[model samples]
Target: MKDTKILLLLVIGVPILGLVYCAFMIGFLLLVPWGQNHPIITAAIFVLTPSIVSGSIWLISSARAKK
Candidate 1:
């Protein structure tokens, strides 16, 4: 029961935090004229950074699993 509640909180809270962060970034991009001008780079950075980070985490986890 306790574990279930903790898992439920994690499921709900993580997405809320992600949404809030996205909202802030979107607001910042809109507020900054440079963001409008260099949208491609900004988008690439946002999209690729997560991909790279996930890939790195996956590699580390896989390596640990092998050890």
Candidate 2:
């Protein structure tokens, strides 16, 4: 039962936070002058950062579950 709550939090919370972060980043990238200078970096940050974070979380959780 406790695990169910944690699972639900993980499923719902991470994505909502990710979306909010993405929206903020998009706005930041568009509004800031520095953001305009490097389109590739901005694009990569939007694309890669979340995958890396989520992948790391998944790896740690899976490892914990195996124990």
Candidate 3:
């Protein structure tokens, strides 16, 4: 039961956290002016950072599990 609960938490929590991070990144991008150089790079960074962060969090959490 405890293991199932942890699995459930990871399944639900990771994606929700990732989506929230993505939303924040999108909001920040929207607030930025379009005239800047390398807009594509900026956009990529905004999208990728949160994803990487979320993946790292998931990896770390799973690695530290007692099982």
lDDT of each: 0.87, 0.90, 0.79
Model 1 steric clash pairs: none
Clashes of each: 0, 0, 0
- Once fitted onto the true fold, the runs of candidate 3 whose alpha carbons sit more than 4 angstroms away are 34-38, 50-67
Residue 38, model 1: lDDT of: 95
lDDT of 2 by residue, 1-67 (tens): 6999999998999899989997899898879988899988888887898789889999999999999
Query: Which 10-residue window of candidate 3 scores lowest in summed lDDT?
Result: 29-38
TM-score of structure candidate 2:
0.70
Specify the highest-lDDT model's number: 2
Better of 1 and 3 by lDDT: 1
Model 2: ten consecutive residues of lowest lDDT = 41-50
- Model 1: which ten-residue window has the lowest total lDDT? 42-51
The collision pairs in model 2 are none
Candidates 2 and 3 compared: the better one by TM-score is: 2
Better model by TM-score, 1 or 3? 1
